[model samples]
Each structure stands twice: as structure tokens, then as C-alpha cells.
Target: MADSPGSGAAFPSQSPRTKKYSLTEEKIFYMNCRAAYLTVFKSSLENIISKDQLYLVLQHAGRNPSQKTINKYWTSQTAKLNFDDFCVILRKEKPTSKADLLKSFRQLDVNDDGSILHTDLYKFLTKRGEKMTREEVNAIINLPDVNADGKFDYIKFCKLYMTTNEQCLKTILGKLEVDSKLKCQQFGSHIEGTLERDPSPVPKPSPRVIRKTNQEMFSNKGGSRSPLLSSTRNFKTSVSLTITMSANSNQNPKLTEPNLIEDWQCVQSKGCFFLEEDGKIISHQYRMHIPEKSMVYLTIKPLKLSQVEGKPSPWLSVDTALYILVENESQANLQPLCFTELQNREVFGWTGELGPGIYWLIPSTTGCRLKKERKPVPEEALLVYRDETGKLFLTKEFRSALSDIFEVIDLDGNGLLSLEEYNFFELRASGEKCDEDAWAVCRENFDTKKNELTRQGFMELNMMEASDQGGDPRDLWVILHSMGYNKALELTEACPFVINIHAEKCKPRIKAVCMEACNGQLEKTICKYVLTNGSAKSMDGYENIIIYTYKHDSWITSVIENKLDNKLIIHVNNELSKNCVNNKGLNTYVVEVAPKSTMVCQHVMPLNERQEWIYHFLSSIKWT
Candidate 1:
């Protein structure tokens, strides 16, 4: 669920060469490449945009240009620059103004003496431009007149950085023009206060139930996808839901369009799947066929400044894992709703399946991959395992990383797919749920149409399931390391493996049921109304390595099954209490198991829904 900020390929302010700029210079050069993309990788990276973070955002926006003018936007077909080619770097990029920050402080004031020193304004604000940090040049050398003796005035510090960067570019383009008129409204969007009805509401934050561990990490076989190389106030959320529907007796269960929350608004928890397209409605969804019983009522809020007054915000909201699809005949329960605010909004709920009809909830981040446990083999399966030709051929760098995982599972590209995008890419590579007779055996053995699939039939069905596993790339490395591949097989949504976060009293999250799977996975459906759908109960570990645990009320979703014959190495831990998550799919993980593969290692959950998780999980296995 990656490209959808009304995708013109994720973000297109205009073309024909940015239609000769101006939309306020393409929204201030697309907000200085989104403030150098939240200063080089927001929740830490992987929507690709490097050339040293666009020459450190054009040397901190003074635009020093040149590295052969950023090597003509790195072509060979633009090597790297997503986020709409890092905001049209394929050409237009001149929006620094205030006379280009006073001609870069008059060429770093080298004796034209408006004033300099303090080691040449700390190497012109850290090695020649906007790389400032050392507490932002000690808050500009402790501001107030600035310089008991150090030095100051380069034309009053370039109008004190052009009056705080033209009011921080008009307060971030007035909060992205009110998030671009509530994502170009057709309807629904109201939250400034008014959601008061609570006899008892704020009591839903106690989900962190995990169990599976022995802990380990090796990596070295000259193979397992390249000798295991390893590597957030990540506060970015978008909430807007208002589903309300009540019916049991006094009629009114069929309205259809009276109010699907006024035409659906914000469910964007940045890791989208709040699926309700901007297409004004059709197959994008808007159902209401009830023959009886109904009581759906959702209000979740946050975003209303006259519903984004002028609309124009594209591609800039993604962290991964945000859902709300209320489809149920009940199969584990299909989770990811954890939001819990109470009086002013953000709560989420669920009830039975007593039938009659009325179940259109819609909102998803693709049922975040869920979790498990076990022992023995407990000390040989580390992380990376090379496979230098141990055979699952395909290489041209694995078909350009499986055509970038089929353009991130073709969300709405029209190349084809949709059975909810191959069951969200078969639940992040096999944790289960592709049904419809396995999408009709992937539309009768590949290359489908109308029945969807396509993209050369999803790369000829992953090269015929890696040649029916006889060429075993462990189901293509569990769909390329659970969608963030690396074996120099390149793809990096970056940071996840302890990004030196130090919150101390609080703060640090990234776990919407972090994917890691094995075994015929599909259990975490809110504890399957007390275990039923595949409840073999207990068959104690071994039989080709396995790990299982899927309890949820707030967190803990794991699954792993590698009916081993070869490629093995598992060691997931994710402790889940007083939660300290360091991402790579939750704490202390070291994966590489592909024999008869089944994956989804972790997706913990918290960072909002009124924060409070104690999730747990642990596993141990290793033996080639």
C-alpha cells in the first residue's frame, strides 16, 4: 500500500517538465524535498532519495549546486530518487529565496566582513550549509545579541535565517494547505472538538501478548543473501474515521450513501490501507446491503482546519501498517485497529457475527503480518546465508528485485492484481490468506486478466514459485525479506535495527505486528474467538522448524514455518513489556529460513491507540 497520495506515481504536482514550475515554485521545490525528507529519512529512510540526501538538500537550501549539477539528476534512468523523483529533481529546483539566503551569507562572508568567526559560523553551519546540529549551532550561539566575544552579524545572521525561513515556509505551507483540503474532499472531515459521550470509554490499551525465544544471531555461510549485514520521535499520524451505523430493531439498516462517514475521510495512519479511494466511489467501496441486524459506529478523529481549504498534498504519508477493513466471516479476525483516545475520538471496536448482513468498514494497512515460538536447532541458523548458486536462479539482481516487488504490490497502478492486492502480497509472504481457491490458483496458473494478477503474471508467478521450490529460494526469500530486501538485492526503507533512540522515560515505536512467518500462518485474528481455525492445539516444535504465537488485543502477531530440508536459521525474540522495540521487525531478530517457507516475523503495535503495549515473543533455531 505504498503509492496513493492520489498517485501520479505517488506525487505529481505537474509535468511536461513540471509545467515550467510555479505552483509557488512547485510548492517551494516540493517543500525543500520535504525538508530533505525529514532531514534524510524521516522514520529513518526508504522511499529512496539519495545523492547524499540531494546534496544535503542543496547544501541546506543555499543551493551550492554542482557535482556536475548533481550529475544531471543521476540518470541512467534516474538511479535513485523516489518521492516523485525527490520532488522533481529531474529538472526544476530553484526556491531558496531571500535572495538565495543572502547569496549564501555572502559566500560565507570570507572577509567581505559582515561578520564570521566561531570557526567560520561552524563551517558555515556545519560543513558548508544546513547540516546544523550541535543543538543547532548551540541555538545560534545562544542567540540574544549573539557573541560575548565570539562574533556575529553577517547582515544580522542573514536576516536570522530569513526570518526563520519565511515563517517556516508559511508554517509548512499552512500545514500542507490543510493536508490539501482533507485530501481533496468529496466529503467527511470534522475534528476541533465535539465527540462527547462517554459513560465508560477510555479503557482499551492492554495488548502485548507474545511468547517465543532463546535468542541468537550468527550470519556467515558465504551465503544466506550476503553475510548478514545489519542495521525515532517518529510522530507522524493521520486519523479520520466516522463510520456510524445503528440498526437492530426500529429499521434503517440500508442507507448505502446517506453517510459512509460523509464520504469517508482520513484513516491514514501513514502505512495506508484505509482503502476508500479518492475516485469519488465505485469499486473503491461504499457498501450497505443488510437484510437484518446492524450496529456499526466508528468516530475516530484528528484533522479539521476547514477540511484543508485548498487541497494539494501528494505522496508524503507512509510509515507502514494502518488498517480498518471490517470484512468478517471471521478467520482469526483480521486485525490492526488499536487506536484508543476516548472522549475526543480514536477508539475502534468489534462485536459478533450473528448474521443478516451489514459489514462495510474499510480501512487497511494490509493486515500487518503476525507471529510464534519454539526451541532446538537453537544454535546454528544465524542471519545472512549467501546461496552463491545453491540455486534459485532469476538473477538480473533477482529480476530487479522482482520488479520492485511488483511496484509494491500494484496498489492501483492498473497493471493488475487486486484480490485486495494479492491478499496484501499473500500476507507479507505467506502467513496465510490468499483464498478464493488460492486466488483461483493464482488465476489458473498465472497471467490472469479480469481475475486480475498480471505484471507478466507477477513475474511468471515468482518464476513459477522459484521453480516449484526445486530451485528453492525459500519462496523467494519469503517475498524478499518481508518487503525490504537486501543482499545488495537492494531496497531499503532504511532504519530498523536499533536506530539509537533514547527516550528514557518514554517514546520509541515501529511494530504494527511486524512480519515474520513460518508454518501455515493465519491465527492472530484477534485470538480466533478462543482458537479454532487451525487449532491443532500442540504438536511440540520439530518437523522442519516452526514457531507459533498469535495473541492480540493490542500487540503480538508472528508466524514462521519452514518445513526444513535445508536453508534454516531463525532467532526472533521481541520481549514485549515496558516495550523497547528497535525495529527490523521488533527487537533482537535474525532471520533466514526458506526450505518450505512461511514468514512474518514481527509487527508489534503501539505508537498510538493511546500507547501501552506489553507484547511478547521469543524463538530459537539454527542448524544447517
Candidate 2:
């Protein structure tokens, strides 16, 4: 009474028969037909169905069709149908019974694991003489692998299989549209019979409406173009068309533009923004639109070590937190606008709605807490930003040299530097010239008694030097040099202070002065120099003195040299200078150096009688 299932005859009794079947029965029938088609065709469901395969499926569905008829339909509609569309056609054909559907599923589920695995499916297809690559088999498994765990659950598989048909059909139709347009543009001729004979009943809009829609879809509206769709003109004819089609579809008319919707989806999925070459938001979000004000989209990419010049330290990693701080032009201090704590190699972005005004777009990696007690020291922070016009800018006054230096030297990141760490930093900053004398000076002046230097202490020391009373950075250089931080003085002069101390040229002269005054007992001597107008009349005039102490004889000595003439003018408590003066006819005078003391010295000594200090000043020297 009913045409054989494979006979090329219309299902004359299908309407009455379909009415008898419940929804579940119909679904069973659809799944049976789908299983049969997949098994018989020996191909994946997601793969494009060939014309001969479609014809065979049509015949099996009881839609009787000759070769000529099938060809006409295939050419008129999409040349190929994906598995989802094939399932839709099977549903239209109606199901026989639930028993048959269960049997078909059982046949495919050979391993009977309650779900289908790619390996199981592959074996089944191979037994059926289907030659498919591993990639094809995996693609089929992924079709129903909604969770992407490499396997398909039976219930989820069925639900997704049925619901995704419309989306698949839309994607195919969009591809066809793009292909047809490309053909028309290339050949300047339409395929005569193909379009007119299309079997689907999608109503066509007028030429004017189509043209207007195309213009709207392709127009570059103020936003940045998506990097994914950058080369739209070069898209493949058969690629997954993400654009929503307008022809006879239920999609919103205003949202017909593919780029806008696709871009938004891209950003939402990635949780980050990418900018095009023209500084436009790559994945622009249309939903984030604000009224009367444009959105300022921000994106920051983590740079590799090689990308940064003179990177202060290697502690910076790809996962470093980046922040964008926004401050009003009238505000004196910087305030944070937004921040992103990204994973290693992650791109960060933010969108903000603001009116036209001068805004500071400061950026930082330092996680400086805004609490009153945890505020960042301004001198140790680096602030970079961009303007409204997208011109990159930075704060020239905010120096990070101290922070960079500290970070490089603080190997343990404990906010404190041990003597070794401080010395290492000093060596790096100033080189080998940062000898014991330099460290001693640093420790004494900074009160680093426990052989530790806190970050705060280092910052204060830097600040004190930077903002010194004379505004001469070399003043710190002189102090550091006197403290035996010769290398540190040099480095400070070169980097943060940027002074030309000529330390290398002065090294030999200073060393020779110490050797002569200390009788070559340089290791037992502590030398300190003051750069000042050496004239006795100048208030800043000070003696160039070396305080020497002998470890062997417990002898103390003070060697004072004339700054202007390099003359060894006087010695305090120096047995050698005293012996040389007494034995050799070295011109000398007895001068009172303190309230109750006198010392023999050359007459050329650059000191007033009241200021002529004792030769034993080392024994009475104040620790401070």
C-alpha cells in the first residue's frame, strides 16, 4: 500500500501516517533515517553531502526523484547539505517507529558505552567500507561533543542535532550568497537557471533594498574594523559565514551587518580587545554604545623582554598585572581608571564612556594599594599614558630609576636589602669602585646598622639627594664618594643624577694623595673629600683629610692636603709626618688645631689658626 522506502515515488500516504505518530516517534524516525544515511553514504554527518548522496537520500525519504529532477533541485538550492540539514530533511520525511530508531542507534554504538566515541564511530565506518581520515572522524564526534570532552552524550547529541539544523542552514545560505556575489563580480554574468529554480521558498527583497543593505553591512561606521575580518575581500567562498542573512530570515533588520555582530561576539568570547592598525577597536562591542558620547576602548599587550629597551629587571613576567589610570586634567594626582590582572601572554582591554575632556590615561604594572598607609612613593613609580587623540604620552617627572635599581638588586623581593644585596646593587650601579669605604658611608649615613636597607630607606636616600638644597646632584656624588661608594657615585652620576663627575680621572690623584699622606698604609686609612671653594674666606671651605689608624701600632693620623695646590700641608698625630718634619728640614709650624691642642704643619696649610685641628683627630672623631 505504501511506496517502498527507497522507491523514487512521492509519499502519498505520509500526511495521514505522520498524524498518527507522536513527537517522540517522529524524532525516532528522523534519527533512524539519519543513521541509515550516514551508514549508507559512508561519510561523516558534518561533511558536505554530494549530489548523488542527496538523490539517494531523497529516494529513501519517498520523495521520488529522477536524476534530472535531483540535479535541478541540488543546483537550485545549496550544492551540498551538511548533516544538520540532512537531519531536517529526514524529519520532513516522517518516522516509522521508535523501535527502528533505537535499533539504528544501537548499530552505530557498537561498543555500547552509553555514548559514542570517535574511535567507536571510526571503527563502525571502517567496517562499512567507509574511507575517512582521523580528522573527518574527529569532526563528526565534535558535532555532538557540546562539552568538547572528545565524546558525545546520547541525549545532548540528539537535542543539539535537531536544534542546530536551522543555524547550519543559515550558514550554508550565507555562504551561497557570498559565492554568488563573488561569481557575479568576477564573471559579470549570473548563472541563468540556477537562482530562478531554487526549491526553498525564501522571498527576495527589491534590488534597491538589497543594495541599501549591502552598503550598510560593508560601511565602516566610526568604529575600528575587526582584525579577523580585516581582509574581508579575500574570504573563501565556502568559509563559515558568521554574518546573519537578511533574505527571508527572522533576524533583526538593524543588526544585519556581519562585522559588527561578529566583532562583538569575538570580544565577548575572548574577554579581551585587540586594536587594528588604525588604532580602532578590533572586536568592537555595539551593545556598549553610549548616547552622545564615544567609548574609549583600551588594550594593552604584554611585551617580551626583548621588546623593552633598558628593562630594569628580569622579575617582570608575562602575567604581570597591568592598569590604566584616568585622572582629570585639573587634578594634581593620578587616579586609576581601570585595571586588568591577566594571565601570561594575555591581552587586556576596557571600554569606558566619557564626555570630551582632557583625561590622563596613565598605565602601571605596580600594584600600588590606594590605602593611606600603602601609597606608592611617587619617585619610584613609572607612569605612562595616552591622550584623547590617541597620541602616546608619559610623565617625564615621575622617575622609576630608584625603583628599577632597587628591584634589580632586591633578589629576594622582601622589600629589604641585606648588605650583600646592597653591595651587589652598588656594584651594578656604580661598578667595582663601590668598595668597603662606600658601603661604610652608606651604612653610616642611612643608619643601615643591621646590614639591611628597606625600600623606604632607599627611596628616602634617593629623594634627599635628588632634592638637595644646592640642586646639584653631584653633591650626592661627592657624599657617596667620600663614603667610599666611588662606583655608586659614578653610577648615580650617570643614571639618575646624570652628572659628569670625572671619577675615573680623579681616582689616581685621590689615591696618590691618600698614599702619600698615609705613608702607603692606604688599607688602614679612611679618606673623605669635600668639593668646595677651598679659600679660607669661603664659608664652605673644608680640609681634604684622611683619617688613618694603624692596626699594628695603635697609631692614629690625620692627613690634610691643600685642595688648590695638591700640597701635603699638615698631618695630625702621624709619627711618619712628624719624624719626616723633625729629621728633614721640612718647613713647619706649631699650630693650635683645637681648643686645647696644637699641631706642627707646613706654613702653606689652607687653615685659619682657630681651625688648625689636632693630628690625633681620628682618636677623638665622632661616630656621627
Candidate 3:
């Protein structure tokens, strides 16, 4: 596979196990219902039923058992059970012949006991529990009550219990058989209801069902074997009886034929057309109905010439446009328009329906509203493009303005114009010749070997040259003023820089080197200075003056300079020396200052006060 654009390179495919199912609300609700029914069934069967047998019954009724539990049950020996074995347990041992029933009862009389009492009934029911109902219990007792005694002997109990157990098993198993004929008829009624709501113009019997029963059984299409259900004839079931009550009722059908033409009308009304399978009006077409407002895309094609003037006039043809009628109940009286045109010489239209009793003309000139062709907007050229060296490069429209003067100075087509080019323009306005030596210094220091000065380089060179002769660099500053350097630096630092200088108004550190001492201070009396790399360390010495200590970590540094009464106080953070380290070496320095030194240092550290408070609270307070 090709690498995706702008991604640089390709990586190996991810593991297949990464995908997972998202169990939405509807899915969880369905599973909860299935689980409830499964739990009830398992309880009824007790320990005799295997999980697999129960799963089969639930599966037939449309339920998904988790694979993990199914696998665990299948491999477990305690729970493994065959369907036949379960059937035998459900039926119990009962006599099919009356002769055998009498003989079996005789065998149960272990001690020639003549009568069965409460003990025998209790033992039988204690094992069976409520599986057999009260009515069943009465019937079993009455079965062998010989001589109308109203009580069963041991012999009577054995015969009657076996007979009752057989009847119960047969009833439950009979309920489980799947009726194929019923499935087909129900699926058929679903299809017919859709057709009745949205009848097609084409004359053909609508599909009443999906015929899943036939599909499941038949292996070959035209086999010699007769179909279990008749193929050519329609099958009817009790569903028609249910349908008769609501046959003409206003209840809408859940499924309907595809609105091939209905969609075409929506597009046509807005002055558009639709073609292809979406608007195909024909017999034996397959369609399904989705819930209203469900997301679905519809396409449209214009009507054609022959279709417009048909033998009988159809709503859509080659000349007709399509329109859509949307039901927008969310917003009051909202009408949305969608239209498309034909790239070909002529157009075609298909029949469409809007709603009950509303239809469209297949191909008519007056059927659609005509759309006028729009004209293109006019454009004008501005100036020819030029490089930084003032060389023409490309022409552009007048509306296209240069970002800065550096764009005009890039003469060699290099990204950055050379220093010579910058000086040439700087001096051009002044009506003075360019200084060759000064220009060389600016070029060597600022311009990259591409022999180009980037927008930034051009501005810096212009400003430096202008300032060297005591000239204002405002012209250069204006060209690069769009960029807010202070804002950019502030965002990266996460906070604003604060400059504090406490100097006397009379004698401030305002000289070139001394003005630099202002660092970042609020004194307007001192001037602003841009400190480049090497220029910073050159003026580091401050004789008899306290210099703020430098830090090398992410920290909030606060510097305060006091110049009151000829005294200076410096506070360097000496917390680490006082708390963490105490060894004295050459690496560590201790300075002693005289009273007139004009500077003082102090170290402050934090104390664990919470510990002291907790200790006091526990010792002084008493519990009531």
C-alpha cells in the first residue's frame, strides 16, 4: 500500500485483536431480556438439564449466549448431558401397558406392605418438587385408589406416579417444535402490509414474505424433489385473521417499497434530477422501510426529452427537474432546496410520489421551475512581483499586498535577500550612497549563505545600520511590526515578565552599559536594550553593587533593587546550602561584608508546621 500523504512513512498493520464491540443501550436491553428468560428456564429444569440444551432453546427464540460461558459448560463433566438422557429423565419410567403397570406396582412392595401412606407420597413429591402441579397430584392419588378408599397403597403409588411423569414430559417437548409454515406466513404478511401502504404503478403481485423456510431446505433451484411447501401458490395463515381487524386502519406499515420516484420528486422540486436504480420505476423491485429521520442518502436525475412528451404525459422526463418534499417538524415551516443539472445535452425523469394523492409529471416543461445561468466575477491585476534585491519575479493582482518591505527586497529569488540588497533600498530613500564596509559587516553577521536575508534578517540589518548613525529604525520596525514578539515569549513562559527597579530619580543607572543594568525594570528614565548572546556577559561586573543571583531551573524569580540612602540589598536563595548541604570546600564560598558594603544576603526555608500542630492537638485534647 502507498504511504498516506504528509505522513512521511508507513508503519506495520496493527494487531487484529484491537477491535471490540460497543454494546449500546438497545443491545444491552435485548441481552437483559434474553438472560432473564434463560435464568428462569434453567431454574425449572434443575440440575438435570445441561447448559447446551438450554442454549439451543434460547437460540431458537433469538438469543445470544456469551461464548465464554458456553465453552466452560461444554468442557465441564458435571454439566455434560445428552438431549436423549434429559428426555428420559423428564419422562421418567412409566408403563405403556396396563398389565406391566400392575406388575411394576407389585415389585415396589418391598416388605409385602399392603398399604402406602403419607410417607410414600412425601418421598415421591420431595424428589419431583413442584414440577407436577396440585391438579396432577390429585389425579395421581385417585388413579390407584382401589375400593374407593381415597388413599393409595404402596402398589397404587408406584403405578400412578410413573403414568403422570410420562404425560408431563410429552407436553413440554411438544411446545418446542418449530412450525416452518407459520414462520413463512408471518414473514409474508410483513411484506404485504408494506405493499398496501405504498402501491407501485407497475402491475405485479407484491412479495409477501422473504421465504426463509424454502431457502433453508432447498439445496438446488430446480430439483426433482417436490417442495415441502408449494412453490407457485401463495400460503395463508392465521395472520390474515389478525390483519382483517386492522386491514384499513390508519396504522402505518413498518416496511415499504423503495421510493425510487418519491426521492426524484424531492430533488426535482428544488430544480434537480435523479437517475440509476434509486429512481427506477419497475415491477418486482426490492425495497425496505427505515424509521423516519434515520440517516439515508437519496440521489436524483433530471427528466429527459422523450420522457417529457410521452404517449401519456409522465411527471418526469428528459426536460423535467426533480424536487424533494421534506417533513421538517423540528423547525416551523422550514423548506430545504436541493438541485442538480445535467452535464449531457438532455435530461431524463422518473415517476415520483410526494404523499397520499400527490404525484409528479414525468416529463413536462412547466413541471419544474427554470434556473438561470450565473456569471463569473471580474478580477484585476495589481503589480509585478519582485525579489528582495528589487528584481522582478512574478506579477500579481492589485489586491495582493506584500506582507512587509523585505518581500520587495528579496531580489535573487533566495528566501532571504543579502545585506547589500537591504542597504541599497535603505540608502535609496535617504538619497545617500550605501556604506560598503558597514554593508559587509551586516551581510556577514546576519544573512545566511543562501546569499539571502530572511524577513527577520532584513529587518535586523536595516535597524542596526539605521541606529549606528543615530538614525531611528522605525521604518525597519514598521515592516516587521505584524509579529508580537512579547506575546510569543509570554505564551512559552506561561506567565508575564515583571521588571522592578528601585533606583532614585536623581542618579539612575541610565547609561548604555548602565541602562542594560535595568534588566527588566519599570523605569522609563532608563532606555530599552535588546541583549544578544555575547553582549549580555560583557557587562556582568557591578562594583560595590549587589547583582541578583542567576537560577537554572523552572522557578519564579523575583528581583528587587533598592538605591535608597546609597545602600543596596541582595537576597540570594541560600536554602539548599542551609538545609541540604553543610560541607565547606573550594566549590562553596562564604563571604563576610563590612557594614558599608551596601549589600546584604539572607536565606529563608520552609518548616513543617502541620506536624507540630498535629502533635499538639493529640497531646492536649481529651476525648469525651
Candidate 4:
């Protein structure tokens, strides 16, 4: 998973240097750059904000800044950063208030016109004072101004901003390395310079060939003095903001307390009066463990009420929750009860092998306030994997945020998903899940019987979910039905491919006596008889039977033996029916071999073209 929201370095809000730059500096810089582009292009600023850009900005390059630092200097912080610095932004604290957003917006509107006129938009832009042509503004307004109103307003601006921001954010999030586009625009020249120095670009690493030289450079050689080791030791110091909620009011801690490992402080605020590191916040998260098998109730207090900012609310939930089965404490090590199970509930009681330990919870679009009210004892622990898991896993708080990527690819929850089911998540956003080579890569790296997946699978699936879809696999319900399954839903909480569905035309049924035979794959090669009416009628002077066989690893071959009592038979294989050809009065029989099978692994009838396909449709069928 990517770094948790709270793991990034802090930029102190009260830094002496920051005081020199007004909070509007950052927003003004960004708005100016955008205005510069718009001015040069003679277009509205609408296209300037893309989804990818918004997501990247929201994540603050994946850094989390403190609310104090943000409220203090948000308007002044520039989005421009070297690739390394951009990453630092993701951990910064996200602005969680409408007031803060309006402040940021005002910074963008240099003229304070409640609108960004093409001319005013250019004020902060650094185009060397280049001006936008009137024609350009007209064109931009025409394409984006759905209302066709003469001038641009907040509604139109927002529509355009959201559309572009969604696209840009996806692009940025999908990247495993620096964006090729960004690199091409910014560092392409630098790379060329490096190539000129070496006359050869670094060779790409192959799976089979390990780069021993690079490995050794990073490896710690006991008591050895090396340049790399020297560089590693030269690092700045950092501290964590800790909070120990105590019952006594007199116990309030101070920054100078002896117990303070490093310089730290606290504030008595209405909400979380906890310690916070000094720094600008980019994005952040908090994870706390609830006792295993405890009854959990959760609720979120809205941090922001406006969509003025480009990305979704930064306050988000984790993907999976742990419900450790305490009785069989041995299983607790697995974190067996992942967030997938507890994601949807504001309150619920779970009984299981909750080993004695801490279990973390993540709530979405809001922080969670958990109150445990139950004890764990003898109830058998049952695991749940469902729609809620998809929601939970997307948050930075969950360790398994990327868990959906590697879930088994069965969109129909049939214990298997074919290549088609697997692709559903890959063909989504471009590079977030896997390289452009995801389809080929996953095929080479998946399991069949166990339906296992790898990290590559998870990334590909995750990228898909977070992109065009609602960031939820359940949204792919249509895709699932189109693929021959019904009621497509998410698999376990953290897995995208482990779906549940019904086949339109499920297993074939045998209402009357007939004869059939199948090979291991059930191709339906031969048939002696098939049932036409509800009953076999009078076979008169004919007999029928069905046979199936397969081989074992060592020597033994398993064979299914049965006799044709002419009681009931359903023809599955077309070939089998053909073989039983032209019986006419001799009692004609038909058979066709379809891949349909039961959950218990019994070979059942495959649906005919006329029936609506489903996976377990045979559940209502009467059998002897």
C-alpha cells in the first residue's frame, strides 16, 4: 500500500521563513500559472484543472500537512515541485472546511471578480505578461458553458474543473514512476543531458537477472565505511505527535514534559486536542485498534461541506477491518477479520476466534468514532466479503487499500473468473494498477484451482475500480451480466474479482431418462438417449445410460458408473444427441455438454440459448 496518510514529514506552520510568504502565495502561484496558460491559449481556465491534477494536488503529492499550517499558508503554497517534492505534498493535511476552500478560491481570482475573466486570470500566470485573445475566451466559453450564458460563473467553472480534475488525478495516481508526460515536459531535457554524459540509458531490469551491484550498494556491510552509508547517516531529525487519552483533567501534557521523546506540544481543542507535528499538511490518516470481536459502532463528522476543491474529500476510510477470532487465538495472526467485513456498519456485534489483540478500523468520507460494547467468547467466527470491502479498501487508513487488486478475478463469484472477468478491472484507468502490459502480465501470474492472485493483479483491478467506474466493482454489474453472469456484486471486502453473480442460463436439468457420456472437459462427444417430454414416455424396447471419467496423478482413474433406468435424462452435448440419431419410434434421445457445474462440483447441464444464464439457478430444481 502507499504510505499511510499520517506517515509523511511535517512542515512546521510557524517556521520563520513561511511567515514571509503570505498564505495566498501557493494558490496565487498555481492560479497564476493556470492563468498564464489560459491567457496564452486565449481559453477559459476550465481545462486547466484536470482530475489527475486535482487528485495529485489533493494528495498534496501524497504528503499530509497539518490543518494549522494549511489554514496559515494554504493560499501561498505553490503546486510546482520537483518530482521528489511533489511526493512530499501527499502527506500534508487536507483543508477540511468551506472557509478554507473559499480562501483558496479567492487567491485564484486575483481580481476578486467572483469570476476568473481571461484577462484577470492572467495576472498570476507567468507568461511574461502575454495576453489572451478575445476569440480564445469565446471558444472556451462556447464548449464548456452548457447554459450558453454570456459569461463564466461558478457552476460552469466547477463542471469544467471536475471533469478535467478527474482525468488528471487518474493519470497521476496510475503512475508507478514519474509521469511520462510530466517527465517529457519537465525532465526530458535533463534525461537527455544524462544520456549525453553516459551515451547509454540505464538498461531495464529483467526478472531473471538480479542487479547485484545495486543490491550490494544498498546492503549494510557490518562495520564498513562507505560513501553510501555516509550519505545515509546524514539525515535531519523528525518527531511524532502522540496522544494518550487519559481520564484525569490535571494530567494534560506539555511540550516540555520529560516524557516527550523530542519537541512536541498539545492543544485543548473541541475535537481532537491531540499533539501535531509542526508542518504544512498535504494529506493524513489515523488508524487505531479496537479490541477483537468487540461490538463496533462508528459515525463520521463532516470535515468539509463543499466540493469547491477538485478531489473527493480527503477524510476517508480504510478497506478492511479486523475481527480476530479470539477463541482460536492462533488464527488471529492472519488479521483474519479484515476491514472488508466491518466497513458498512455504524454498529454491529461480531463473534469469532478473536484472538487477544488490537484490530484497526477505517471509515469512509469521514473519520470513525468507535465504541466497543461486546465481549468475545463462544460464537463461531464467520468471515464476510462484500460490497463494503470495496469502499473500505480505497481509504489510506486501511493497510489493504490495494487488496482489491489481487482478489480472485471471478466477477460472478463462481469460484473462477476467466480472462474476460480479469480484464474488467485492467481496461479502466491506464497505469495505476499495472504497466500497460497488465493483461499479459496477470495471465502469466495467476492460479487456477485456488484462484489465487498477486500484487500485480490487485493493482490492475484497483486502477480499474478507482477510475471510470464508481471506484466500486459493484458498478461493473452491467459488465458482469454482459459476460454471462447475473447480479454481479463485489467479492470479499478487499477483493475486486472475487464477485458474486448468477448465470442467466445455469445448469441443465434431467426431467426424464436419457443416455449421455462426457470426457474430463465435458465436451459431450456421445449420447445414447435424451429426454424430450416431462417423462421418458415409453422407451419401449430401448435402454439408455450416462458415463464420465477422469485420470488421477499417479495411476488410478476415477470413473462415474450409472445405468439407464429410463427414469430421467437431460441431453447436454449436441454431439451426444447426434450419436443417438434417428431412433424415431425407437425413442430418440438428445444430449449436450456444457461447462455448467454445481457448487459441490457436480457436472450439471449448461444453459441453452433460450434460457437466461445463471450460476446457481438449479437451486430450485428437485433432485433424487
- Candidate 3's C-alpha lDDT? 0.27
Better of 1 and 3 by TM-score: 1
Residues 301-384, candidate 3, lDDT per residue (tens digit)? Answer: 332212112233122222322222233443223232221122122232222222221111111122111111112214322233
Question: What lDDT, from 0 to 1, does candidate 1 have?
Answer: 0.39
lDDT tens string, model 1, 98-141?
A: 66666766776778867667777887677763366667787776
Global Cα lDDT for candidate 4 = 0.26
| lDDT per residue (tens digit) for residues 176-240 in model 4 | 12444322221100110010111122332221232234354335333222221221222222111
The whole-model lDDT of each prediction reads: 0.39, 0.32, 0.27, 0.26
**In candidate 2, what residue range of length 10 has the lowest lDDT sum?**
507-516
The window of 10 residues in a row where model 1 has the poorest summed lDDT is 226-235
The best-first sequence of candidates by lDDT reads 1, 2, 3, 4
Best by lDDT: 1
